[model samples]
Each structure stands twice: as structure tokens, then as C-alpha cells.
Target: MIAIDINKRIGRGPGSFRLQVKTVFQFNSVTRILGPSGVGKSTLLKILAGFITPDSGLIKFGDAVWFDSQIKYSKMVQERNVGFVFQDYALFPNMTVAQHLHYGSDNADYINQLLELGELTSLKERLPRQLSGGQQQRLAILRALSTKPKLLLMDEPFAALDSALKIRIMERLKSLFEEQQTTVLMVTHQDQEWEHPKNQIFNLLSQED
Candidate 1:
């Protein structure tokens, strides 16, 4: 299981607040971190992903210790083997769809499966600029998944997609996650977006209590 126990302080301005979060995120299931804007959802995810360090407490994934403030030990983001998909679907403008997937892994079979899963088999040669917003989002997700990461961290992954496409992509992601049994931790402002029973939804507001 992926266990998290951390207290972080962010935003140097007067609006900043101490983001104290502690929770155990189970593996082999999707965990939705639901909250309103400015709730430090992304901050928490970043800490877990090793993009940022916690001021105190510890974080562990199964037998591995990702972070331990008391021990003064912290792993680098890349060393954590965590995949991240940002809100804007951070794709390289110069890279083709196939290139992005190849960056994740050299396995041709895995790349082909991801391309088929994202429905981008026809657009493999196209650059990010050539694809639609929804297509870009799918490609971004596929690239992350292709890495075969132990944990996937997503920040508002579907915020850029339209309603129809969001639903379709969500369905595909759910199916793929189940098939792969990859652990996912996603932050979303929309509460209804994670209505699927397979996912364990946890509101940050409730988590604070």
C-alpha cells in the first residue's frame, strides 16, 4: 500500500496556510482527491510524487520509503517511478505522438497497446499541435501509463476536455487501470466526475477532519 503522512507549508504570501495531510492511499485502486479550488490538492499530490518535500512526517509506498523527515531522507521525483499528467496535458510541441510514447519506454508492444488504447493509432505521426485537445489529453495519459509507473499522479486531467470526450476518456482510463492494476491518485474539483464504484473517493475537506 501507498502510505502518506506529511505536513507542508506553501505560498509565502499572507494567503498561505499550513497544509497538514495524513492518509493511507491503497494500491491497485484509484484514489480521487476531491476538493474546491485552493485546497492544496495539487500540493499534496506533488509531495507524494516527490516533486516537493514535506516539512515533517513520512511517506512510503509498499516497502519503499519515499519520504521521511525525521530521517532526513527523500527520494527524487524520477526515482519515485511516479507518472504525472498535468492539467494542460503537458506535451512537447516538437515531439510526435510516437516519440512521446517512446520516451516512456522502448518496448514496442507496450507503445502499440497504449496507442490503441488512447485511440491515437492513426495520429502516431502527428505532433501535439496537430491533434485536438481531447486527443492531446489521451496521448498525455497514454505516455504516462506507458512508463509502467507504480503510482500515477494526475492534476485536473480532464479539465480541458469537453463533456462527451471527458466521459469517453474516463471510461477508457478506468478500463485500462483495471487491466493493468496501476495505482492512481487524481485531484479533481468536480465531485461527480468520479462516480464509478471502482474508485475510492476522498474529499480533502473530509480528510482534514
Candidate 2:
């Protein structure tokens, strides 16, 4: 189980917002954080991922204490077994798709499986700049999964794809998650995106209740 008990102040000047997440996320399930644009949804995910520190509270993932403000114990982002996929699809423009997958792991068989699962085999030689937006997004996700992380965090992963492509990718993701059993925490503003099976949806703004 991943338990996040935190309270932090965010933003600048008079337009700042306060973020408080005193909740527990179960294991091996997809938890979708739903809210408006500037409601600190991504910030909460960042804190959980150990990219941001809170003024007070503790974060425990199973037996590991990832962060504890009272004790001043905080793990680095790399130390946590997390796979993060940003909304913009952060990929090296000069590197080929094959190179990206290989960079995460040296296992050839795993790389081949990722290529097949992501439908990226055909585009292995293509660079990020050469691929379409959706293709780039697929590559980004594949790269993250290559790390074999216990927890996967995605921010608006399907925002750049069309509805048809989104549906197809979502199906593929469901299969991949089932096969790997990786815990996923995804943030999205669209309600229709969280209709997948076995997913727990939580509205961030309503979290206080």
C-alpha cells in the first residue's frame, strides 16, 4: 500500500493554493486523480514521487518510508522505484526509438517485448522528432516501463492522442499493467479517460471530504 499524508503550500504571491492529501492508495491498482487545471493535482503526484517535499507529513510505500517531514527523511526521485511519464513526452530528439529502450535496460529480450507491446518495432530506427505525436507518446511510455518500476505515474498521458488512438493505447496499457502488475497513478482532466476496468477514481478537490 502507498499511503500519502501530506500538507503543503504551493503557488506564488496571492494566487497560491494549499495542497493536502491524507489518503491511502491500494497496491496493484490504477488510481486516477481528477480535478481542474490548477488544483495541485500534478503537485500531489510529484510529492508522492519524491520530486517535491511537503512542509509536513509522511509518505510510506509498503514497508519503505519514502518521505517523513517530521523525521526529515526524504528519498531522492531516482531512489524510489518509480516510472514517471510527463505530459509533454520527454524524449531525446536525437536518439532513435531503439536507443531509448536500450538505455533503460540492457536485456535484449525485455527490449524486444517492450517494442512489441508498444507497437514500436516498426519505428525503432526513427528519432523522436521524426515520429508523430502519438508515436512519440508511445515511445515515452515504453521507455518508462523499461525501467521495470513498481510504481508508474503518468500525467495526461493520452492528452495528445485522438479518441480512436487513445482507446487503442488504453487497451494496450490495460494488458501491459495486468502482465506487469505495476501500480499506476495517473492524472487527467477528462472523465471519460478513467472508465477503464478495475480503476479507482478520486477527485483531488473532493479529497478533503
Candidate 3:
């Protein structure tokens, strides 16, 4: 289980608002987080991933204590076993598609599988600048999966892909994630992008601080 009871202050002065949430996310589940613009949806994911620290509260995932503000304890990002796909598709300009996956994992077979799943096997040697926006996005997702993390966090990861490719990738990812029992937390403004009965919607705007 992933339990989060945290409070953060976003921005400074008059623009700042209290960001507080207390929710227990189930294991092996896909949760899509939604809220009004500037509600700290992405920040919440970063905090969970240990990239950002909350002003106060505790964050626990399974048996791991990711954060405990009272004690000033926060786990490092690498030790959190998290795979994150950022909104900008944070790919390295110097690295090729194959190289990106290789950097995260040493298993040749798994890396090859990731390339095939992303439909990037043929373009494995191409760098980010040589690829289209959708291709770059797919590569980003594949790079994150190279580690086979227990928890995956994605922030608007499908914006570049078209409807057809998006569906295909999501379908394939669903199979792999189910097999690995991986938990996913995603931030998306579009509800139609993820239309499935199994996906739980965690609407931040609907929750009281």
C-alpha cells in the first residue's frame, strides 16, 4: 500500500497555497490524478518519487518509509524504486534510443524487448534530435521501463503520440504492468485519454485540503 499524508506550501507570498493530501493508494493499481490547474498535481508525484520534499507529514510505500518530515528523513530518488516519465520527455540529446535503455539496465534481452514494445527497435540507433515528438515520447517511456520499477509515475506522457499509437502502447504496457504487479500514478488533464473501468480517478479538486 502507498499511504501519503503530506502538506506542502507552493510558491511564496500571496500566490502560495497549502498543498495537503491524505490518501491511501492500493497496490498494483493505476490511479490517474486530476485537479484544477496549479493544484500541485505534478508536485505530488515528485514528492512521492522523492524529488521534492513536503513541509510536513509522512509518506510510506509498502514497508519503505519514503519520507517523515518530523524526523527530516526522506529517501533518495534512486533508492525509491520509481520510474518517472516527465511531461517534457526528459531524454538525453546525446544518447540514442538503445543507449538510453542500456544506461538504465544491463539486461540485453529486456532492453531489446523495451525497444520492440515502444516500436523503436528499428530506430534504436537514432538520437533524440533525429526522432519525431511521438518517437521521443515513446523512448522516454521505454527508458523508464528499462528498470522495471515497482512504481511508475507519468506526467502527461502521451501528448505526443496519436490516438492509434497511444492505444497500442498503453495496451502493451498494461500487459507488462499486470504481469509485474506494478503500481502506476499518472497526471493527466484529459479524462478520455485513460478510459478504463479498472483505472481509479483521484480528483484532487474534489478533495478538501
Top of the candidates by lDDT: 3
Alpha-carbon runs more than 4 Å astray in model 3: 191-198, 206-209
Give the winner by lDDT: 2 or 3. 3
Each model's TM-score, in the order given?
0.90, 0.92, 0.95
lDDT (10s digit) by residue, model 1, range 1-209:
98887888777777777788778877888888887778788888888877788899989899999999988999988798888997778899989999999998999998998888778999999999999888888888888898888789998787767887677777777777777778999987673766666668877752232
lDDT of each: 0.83, 0.85, 0.89
Across 39-158, the per-residue lDDT of candidate 2 in tens digits comes to 888888888788889989999999999998888999998889798888888898888999998888899999998888777898899999999988898898889898888899998877
Off by over 4 Å in 1: 191-198, 206-209
Among these predictions, the greatest TM-score belongs to 3
Clash totals for all models, in order?
Answer: 0, 0, 0
Candidate 2 all-Cα RMSD: 2.2
State the lDDT at 137 in candidate 3.
Answer: 93
Q: Model 3, range 22-76, lDDT digits (tens) per residue? A: 9998888889998888888999999988888899999999888999988899999
Q: Name the lDDT value of residue 100 in candidate 1.
A: 98
The predicted structure with the larger TM-score, 1 or 2, is 2
Instruction: Indicate the TM-score of model 3.
Output: 0.95
| Model 1 global lDDT (CA atoms, 0 to 1) | 0.83
| 10 residues in a row with least lDDT, candidate 1 | 200-209
209 Cα displacement, candidate 1 (Å): 14
